[model samples]
Target chain A: MSKRLLFVFAALIIATMVLSACGPKASTYECTDAIGCVTVAPGDPIHLAYDMVINGPDATLGIDSRNGVEIAIAEKGQLLGHDVQLTGEDDGCSAEGGQASGTKLAADTTIVAVFGTSCSSAARVAVPLLSQAGFVIISASNTAPDLTKAGDPNNWPGYLRTAHNDTIQGAAAAQFAVDFLKVTKAATIHDGSLYAESLANQFAKVFQELGGTITAQEAVDPNQTDFKSVLTSLAPGGPELIYYPIFVKAGSLITRQAKETTGLENTSLMGADGMFSPDVTAGAGDAVEGLFVSSPDTSSFSQKYNDYFLPKYQELFGSEPVSIFHAHAYDATWMVMNAIEAVAVKDADGTLHIPRQALRDAMYATKDFQGLTGVLTCGPTGDCANPKIAVYEYHAGEYPPIKVWP
Target chain B: MLRTWRQRITIADVVVWIIGLSIAFVVVYGSIKTIEVGKYNTRVWIDLTITGLALGGVYALIALGYTIVYGVLKMINFAHSEIFMSGPFTAVFLALALYKNGFWNSHPYISLLLVTLLAVTVSSTLAVLLERIAYRPLRTAPRLVPLITAIGASFFLQYAFRGFFGSGLQAYPELGFLKGTWTFGSIPVYKTQVVVIISALIMMLILYGFVQLTKMGKAMRAVSEDKEVAGLMGIDVDRIIMLTFALGGASAGLGGILYILLFPVVHFFMGFIPGLKAFTAAVLGGIGNVPGAFLGAMILGILEAVGPSLFLDGMGIAAPYQLKDAIAFIILVFILIIRPSGILGERITQTKA
Candidate 1:
């Protein structure tokens, strides 16, 4: 009974070891998340990483968002009873930058969620990697439409943004032109960025449909400074209004140069949210006066944004909201935290187990999430912006542009 | 020379010539067709020309850096762009502070001069430092070694600047005096453009006078002609080369100020594009020739500003400005094909021969 029974017991133990090594565990808490799960040890901080353009020409957009995230963390105090720790890589607001950051961040298994890819071009490369890594990626200022469109190949699973889709923005801009500005003849310039190109295209389409004549649509390199040739090209038609939805550097250059162009003397100049910054006033000098810009309506933000958020943002970052998307970022952070609260499983030992796909599902399930932006609802495609866009007129040397359109 | 070229022409050469001829024909034809269409008025043409001249003036100055450095070292200093970046980037703070204190507007010309001096000093110092740290030790290495080192040094300097001053786009305060336009007879030219163009011409004359009239300039030219021979003849080759970098850096720093007058946003990565264009200008002008750099830069500026509409608008290309770079590089390619040594490159060979 001793030797034979001992050999059989040893064989059974070896078989059990093989099964546990190669297959799924039998007795531990079963993870039903479609992609995967993150099992946090007791007392381990909840990990969140931002992959945004925190350092570049577009820094204000991402830094403002990062500040919002930071303030959100400060406000929350904890996430699922675990200390929330934020870390990030700067996307540099370029495709190569996104690839570098995405490749770097995707390798980490502990990152529960990623908040970033401030630009759509960065998102094009980053979202695939982050999604494949089983992390729910949300952005605060990625407004390109194809990112969350239902059938677009760019619309990857587990990707979402609190930023208004450029479809909404472009349409709003066109509406403003037709209704308020009373511009029949229009032209557009884009910087060839995914965001700028799409926004410009959307504006042109909507403008034409609204019975406005689009004289020309032009594009320039984001890094290029010379816009004389381009602006002159925009002039021949003598369009009453010119819309160039581009970033800060090129936008300022265009804003200044358009005035210098001969036929555009009395023409109205407009740019999108990407150019909405104090930097514009600084860069464009006096040329910025009477220049119109379209951005998410900041006045439509929840009451907390003015009272709590602004003062906290001031205390933390020691400046006014540097860009238009800070509220969106704050909303994105709160949305992520709310999802973590819903999906994170707590253990008796204070350990937190967050199923990766479950967190994404919880985020996708967001509805009427009263955010600083407004009441946000996440659809199947994961767009969660209330999206009230308004056109504003800039006085030279001004920080916040005065709202001119409803 | 024509006979030799004809005799030596191979199938590949024939193909290249055909491609080149077609491009030239297309350009000529497109330009004629644009004039016939006449969408742009004379005022527009005059404006384009003025802008081009101003831009080209800046490019000519920047190209001087590349030409002088290449003339001496016979190696491309890829990091020269960073040197260009370092001067104005550092000087931006001074300009901003001056503006903040109301000195920029009330004492505009003095402020301008001060900013220009700081930019020149910073750029020249950075150039000398770059030559000392990144290029000097690698001088004896394989030619490729120094080239690669220049690239690595370029990255190092960019990131270093980024680390020191956070990578936000810094704005240079505009001079109130430089605002609006000053009338020249019946024509109106922007004060900024006028200043840029006139200063460029004046700077060019000064640089030309320096090279032609100064003993150090002769030493630099001798070193460029033959570094070893010049060294054997008791010329301090290292000193001349350092002088060359300093001269180039000064031009670049001055060029940077001119550049920001047109485009005011300054950042760590700002030098990459203008640097590339200036390098192209150097190559276009015949890399080692001074006047060639200036000539090439002027032509390029005009070509970039006016070429798109003149070359493609009649061709019925929508948004011809979108193809501005394409039009520019194509013209550059044709110019090089017809004259491989560059528009002013013949002098270098003639002197060597």
Candidate 2:
């Protein structure tokens, strides 16, 4: 080996050390972060990655959230004198999809922050990886309590969400069922998905606590087509209302088939936010009429949502929001951007250094942040929603259902 | 007879027999217990049975594709599911157009016919193309080669459709005529279910006759029995094989339409579950036997519908419906154990080699 090259390397290191000592000149950026930093060179875009389901049955959920993110990027074209680049992969809204996207996103060190995972099942497997990667991870529509519960196995640090925890949404639905609907007996069906399972269980627990009889608690596969037998079995219980907090496909099938079931002809059917897409009306046809679904009450969203943001969204996307989470997604994107702005260090040369740990701290420290879906606040473990759930009723062929209960 | 049986049976055979009998006993006991409990009425059972029969009809149509293809090619056309998907998935656009223009309700029969025809044509064309492009080149390759290619072809077709149609559910329009109930004596049946059942039966009968009573059907059986010998005796083996694929695919397409009638939701990935069930049905009845496929599909359909409540409910299992698919696979295991050749599967031949 050459002694000359070794001497040159040593001199270069000493020179850098001396230069760093004089970094107070405000011309150079020093990264004193515990974990590391993402450096965006001059004229390079500040890259933010997303891991959301972009295909399949629940594509509406993820694509809508992504549209929110896209809108946010367009609104904030430049951040701290750098272009904001949004790039990412699809999670497919399944556990395997989560693992695949997680592994891929984790390996890419360029990502400054990430937000996504429309479904709770995907987030259960994906969040831990993104969290471990030292990126501030947020979700737009992951409502399962397990993701945000303190010290739970599925919960991870640096993961926060703008979506309401199911504890609030589920109990609210139960209360409405008992107090408003005046239904003494009810049934619940879940598709065995983490989101649906926990949500249905929460609804059942709260319903029983509210002096309502849970006639039956059942489960179905998300891919299952025939719900006639299950509906038939629920008949003996004489449930006045059947609350199925499942996704669109199965939810629609149950809604249609429930009407056909001999004994269940008179039973009222209800679903949750997961089933609150316009697709439900199309999928269930006329049976969608009188269907009740509990979702985030859009009426309570900050005024800009309707006055400015929605108009901008319509102009940009050429359609109404397809799913319920777009506003939540918009808030999540702004939260990430604001956090990045709070922690990132800019050099006079136009390059920027974003310390990952400081970014996470800034995100978790959020409070009274005025954004869509109401004023947002983050808890220690990661719950950060000003949750306002309301139940709405659908009349055939019409959507954006009228909120019938508070 | 006992001494001869003792001489023939091994320890494994005895073990299998005991296990099979125990499962059988549990099933019988469960059924008895459910009836004794009287939680469900005769009406409930009747409705469930009718639902099962309607769905079973669709399964039979899809299963015919698998059974007939296996009979001739000795290769499981794993992509037959996609062929089933291509038909209705494409026809949905036409159906929607008819629906949006108010022609669907005004002329429900024409709409059904048009959709069915488009679905059949699309399915048959895809099946033939799949045979020519994916399977033909690998016919002489190792057995696993074509099998693997079929799976690859299946994925290719699925994503290609996804690319073309976008990965979202395409809701099929409901016909007004197919709404409401037609009471059969004291029992009431939805018009859609009746249509599905009748259409499935007619399709199955037509397919069975075409395969059994036609001259080309004779040539197909000869080729399946001995491909090289049949070819030497003036059979166009390649053409016969393609026809087999077309026929199978057409039935699958028709089956898909019936499937939508019952379920009413269509998508690029819709074919996956039904395709899998139909394959299982084909294997259950007997892979190469048409009638056996139909019988297997009916049993499977009925079991999936009634087994959960009838069997599991008696055993005090909660949410038995979730275990519905589990019951289907368990019954398949039992059937294989008791009769590994399936209800009517022929003995494995040199064709398998």
Candidate 3:
């Protein structure tokens, strides 16, 4: 125990502490794009993260989206010779969860892009944080009209959703009821959610503008299981069609009670993408047999991708995709990858440098890029994919919905 | 005169006056708006009233459990909600099984009876166990100890059930007989609503008779008056307390079945709100008073059902129905502020004092 030996021990402890405290080196990067600067050197993995609902009731939707992203990554062996690594964080389909996941992902500097979130409500909370950090987010599923509409109302400059906005879905529904079904009168109901309320309002407005009378506009507490009184109240109006763009449990109850209730027994029922699930059909039982649902054109994915994607998805996940929007996710993933490759600076030694702002610009510059879903073109507002809405009818004992409208 | 008025009105008093004035203004504004917007449909108003009364009946039954437990123990049995939840949650399995066997649809009344009995039995057993296990050990502890323990027990039961049954909302088996509406001239009353109102009224009457007339009821009253004196008088206070819990549990169980009849979806979180609303009703009625709890529950129920559309809709507030739960608490806050002892609670306190 000499003084020299003790000094050597102290030096070793300090060295260990400093080494453990140090993180990835901060590299200086050449700045060009408007938002801010980001650094990625050669040999660094192109980092991407998915912030979506991976659990809870909407797990199927997010799981399919994740699967699509994985397939896209597999298709691209590497980005500019650097391997691509993807990570996931669950937003739990809640606002608070979105903020938490967004904050965690934003803290990591190396992540060049994000792909998610599955629902509009989650995106509402995540978008501002991610966009402020100069990261581009490409969503495969979020279809709320306000998210990427003109004005970028939520201030998510770097946000883009491949999924079609509910405006198109709601308008398509109104057209089908007004022109095809020839229904003269309609009623719309919402569960007081942003998605459903907006969709219902859009449908009502469109229906009225098209020479169709809106008999009643109603809002119900989603938690209340007994819609009998509400249905009975709405019955006197005797609407030819009742459009409710709500989620599973409440939607199922409405479909069943709307049939059983005295006045609404003959009323035709219509729902939106939220109710277009096997879960809803199972819950509603025979009552949902003839119910119409409007959603994106899921069948429009290219035949080759359809052939390769389904079998490959099955081989990977060991099951069929439970929900729609997988192809949109695949397209979004490739869009992000292609944007990264276009903007990255490659060195002679196989090192890659990706500027965050450049990547965001490249994503916004996407034009008529061939995608599995269809042709993709980035609009001025950052709505990268043009949305096409289709209507499907649920017949009893049918697994997939029967396509009824073009 | 100005000096005198200023001397009487403190800042605290001013704040209270402000809140009171704001609430009054809002209520008045909402009422006028509702009247203007409600389109004067007599039949529709009648239908809403009927639904409110039926819903109130269910609330009354649940409030009784709270009232009885508070009467004897002077502790809010927060876990009593999970007790109410237990019956309907377990009864769904029996209901589902019966539906699978075709007996539910074939012999509807008998199957309903069996389901009610199952719910009551489970609720009673859980209540007794809750008392024996959670509350018994801390009986002599500070009042807060038992109350906190009751809350912990409630969360435990909720999560336990959630784990056991999975977190999905299970729809109650639809009774064929309860689906149709009974028309009284222009006003149509749902068959389920009629059943709920009648059953609740009958159960409350029976409970009143039992508390007034039975031997165990006398012991309960004596113990509630003063446990030491009741013990000195040779009344088995412990037995009376157990009996009280059992009775309260039975009422909650009955309320559970009637509740599912009116609102068929059952879930782990179902008990939390209804249990809380019933507690509010009990407090509004003056917690320890049975008849007061019934009356309070009925008033609460009607207000909750018709208040949103009738009161708020008139004020041009969008989505009034979403604010239904808030209305109940506003009434509670107003009642407590104006009448601290509740509608019937003052008399019982006077007698005891």
Candidate 1 CAPRI level: medium
| Sort order, lDDT high to low | 2, 1, 3
Q: Model 3: per-residue lDDT, tens digit, A38-107?
A: 5545667778899987765456677778999998898888877877899989976667778899898888
Best by lDDT: 2
- 2 or 3: which has the higher TM-score? 2
Q: Between which residue pairs do clashes occur in model 1? A: none
Q: What's the alpha carbon RMSD for model 1?
A: 3.7
> Candidate 2 has which clashing residue pairs, if any?
none
Superior by lDDT: candidate 1 or candidate 3: 1
Highest DockQ: which candidate? 2
lDDT by residue (A1-406, candidate 2, tens digit) is 5899999999999999999877745557677899899998899999898899887888888889999998888888899999998888899888999999999999999998888888899898999899899888899999999898997998888899999999999999999999889999999999988999999999999999999999889999989788988888889889999999999888999999999888888888999999889889889988998999999999999889999889988999899999999999999999999999998898878889999989989999999999989999999988899999999999998977889997
Name model 1 segments beyond 4 Å from true.
A1-27, B1-7
Model 2 chain A worst lDDT run, 10 consecutive residues: A21-30
Where is the poorest 10-residue window by lDDT in model 2 chain B? B344-353
Clashes of 3: 4
Candidate 3 lDDT score relative to the true structure: 0.82
